[model samples]
Target chain A: MASTHLKRTSLYDVHRAAGARMVEFGGWEMPVQYAGIVEEHHAVRTAAGLFDVSHMGEVEVFGPGALESVQRLITNDAARLIPGQGLYSPVCLPSGGIIDDLTVFRLTGDRFLFVVNASRTERDFQWIAEHTRAATARDRSADLALLALQGPKAQSILERLTRADLTRLASFHFTDGLEVAGLRCLVARTGYTGEDGFEIACAWDAAPALWSALVEAGRPHGLAPAGLGARDTLRLEAGYMLYGNDIDETATPLEAPLGWTVKFDKVAFIGREALLAQKARGVARKLVGFEMQGRAVPRHGYALQAEGRRIGQVTSGTFGPWIRKSIGMGYVERAYAPPGTPLQVEIRGRLEDARVVKLPFYRRS
Target chain B: MYPKDLRYSSEHEWARAEGGRVRVGITRFAADRLTDVVFVELPAVGAKVTYMQPFGVVESVKAVSDLYSPVSGTVVEVNAALADTPEVVNSDPYGKGWMIVVQPDDLRELEQLMPVEKYLGLIGEPAT
Candidate 1:
């Protein structure tokens, strides 16, 4: 085999033994799919799928002003969340542009864990540490491993192996020290997939054991080892925003169609004033969902047009499994933002027919 | 792995003569690596395709790849089943996962492609 520069996951050898086609994703050599992308995608959609998402960054943000400091860093109201409750937030720059979108779980009064995207993990931690240098938030990036158990049947499969009372654990809430096949771990009711799932954060050493156990426990339930391929498709179908692709440093919370995460009620934060100003003036380009008229799927950076002139660009596009059609989201003029508005996506420099539709092309039944 | 009856290309596509036209699909090794066959862009009937050039696209969940034609010809048929059932490629890649059919411009060009043993050799598999 040719020498590849991509770093391997903890489960790299396991994936290699499974004949997985590994690809460089966010600097980690992750299995793009174990069996095939569509099968693994449908596995999670219909049955259960396990993913080794150890590349995601998990940092500890605990101090006397942990809630207050976390609240200041993110666009969302993390101070309002109860202990064990998880809330999605976008960490922003001074200009109200996003650094990364993450989920913060208030593990305790003084301790919280912030789960961030894999690609922006290092820079995000650096930015957070630099902001909170005096505040005492510890950046514990090296000590954690993330595992996602997703699909329709994920809960039942997990319930069998872990003693964690998953039924009472509502979406976005979690408890630490749950025993998974005899290993203590922090399991969160948060996932990138729109389907009901859990993101288990475990000790680095316990990853392989817990992974093996989860796979064994999930076997009877039709759970398969899924890769990055299924993960992106599932998230895209759910209308979830990816940090670098969908929104980034040049994209603000207000312009990215994620205004709900920002709370102006708080006195001040990094991007509060900028978000507030945008709120009052109204955003020019809005993130909206649309369906392409043809089979050609629109990809990231593809231009969005109205009538004939280019207006914006597609941030993400795919053949949504649940919807069984080409659906996408893009930043377009607010004039073309409302559902049912006609638009076009310029794919490969040729205009293809499209229509602005409501967000969320798929909702679990 | 490429079967003895099939002709293979360096691009990982396989073509087999079916009813006087060539039936084509990606190899099992290609499908195994690409992992989920989520969506496939099938070529239109009557469209001309050339050797070593792309005729369509195949997308997994995370990446999109081009589908190449090993033989030059006009497309006579395409697998419409993949329009709504792309996973069939993963499940039955050598059988029902066939992508398109084309009447070869040169029948001798089929021999110019990799033979079954050579195809297996190219993919690093033991020839049957």
Candidate 2:
């Protein structure tokens, strides 16, 4: 409740002037909503939504041994990434517990940019620096600001502002030195909303200008400025995991539905052995998606039960606006993780029936 | 504005006496607090409700809150239009957003509720 000492993003003033309801998130004062969560949610789904994601931490790792160091630190195969490509992977503790999930952008042969969660920024930087032998890691979080233009109409809106051939940018690909609104930016055809969008990374001081430009240009396209509330719903509907919520230190990547990112065939990485052992022995619990059968909305920390006994707890839940149902994700007993498995969630001390379903409650056509 | 003719509860519900029955709905203050009501779940008609007990739930995009009954009674009617349009609670809290019509067990219990002035004072709103 005491957020006086919380840090402010570069777009804090802009958010406040727009009448956003601010909340302290991960030690930063960020807007939770500007209009309303449901309204903004539909905006991103039908048209476009602009998001100020400057709070996400950025780390620059550059040296002759950058590739080797990064490959050793991450579970995924960083060697497969060429310049202008980005890879999403989870950084794991040696015991295979997830430290943090991050996106690695290959800038050059010896330079990589890591976009990490704001809450785990310090820890991620420390862990990466301590593990690497020769790669120099610089925390560039304060130097850069990130904006996500997401939705089905995002490309069309963005194409009007930037001269860069956005049509050529594929998913998980980024191009630097793109002139957007006459300002230098690194535009990536990536987003967490499960839509065709772009995330623009630019200088911290230039954030307000870039945000205003996008807002103005995006107005004719039905673009609304969204906040953290809509972001959570959008990502949850997309079946994307949120750090400190869906996956944390207490849960391993294999248990949290991220085993696909853990490449065992790649060179030795931290937690590779433990992950391999877990894979061989099989996991005791697995994360699965579920939809409520009744009107009850599931929430984090809600108990999951089977028959009359508790199985696990819900890690994340929301009234998915697009799906028009209460959807949630939790690590239930592996036996109950199969699609169509019936489960019960204890909401407000009452058991509500729910069914485990395949992930991505909302899939874009 | 708090309606002068309606009795208010500290829990932010308003009740209006209609002969032997009472009309119940959330107050404007409550509706504003629960912005963008996306869903409402009300007790079925003919169901009994107890005073200060949760009889339904109102869900916004970000949160879910229980709706407490202001008086012990039997639900005679529920707003069916809310099933498809819950935002009515925000737009018209006292009119179309009325949650239920209840036949109070005792009409005298309505006198125990606060008047508009007292209820407004409790919520730090000046009495009009």
lDDT per residue for candidate 2 within A228-342, as digits (tens), equals 9999999999999999989998789999889889999998999998989999999999999999996567888899999789999999998888888888999999888999999
**Pairs clashing in candidate 1?**
A36-B35, A36-B36, A37-B35, A37-B36, A38-B36
Q: Write the per-residue lDDT of candidate 1 for residues A309-344, one digit (tens) a residue.
A: 988989998877666778899999888899998888
- How displaced is residue A43 in candidate 1, in Å? 2.4
- Per DockQ, the best of the predicted structures is 2
Please name the candidate that would achieve the greatest lDDT relative to the true structure: 2
Candidate 1 docking class = acceptable
Note the Cα lDDT for every prediction shown.
0.84, 0.91
Per residue, candidate 2 scores C-alpha lDDT tens digits across B1-128 of: 78899999888999999989999999999987776787788989999999989999898767888898889989999999998778899889999999999999988888989999999999999878
TM-score of each: 0.91, 0.94
The Cα error of candidate 1 at residue A211, in Å, is 1.5
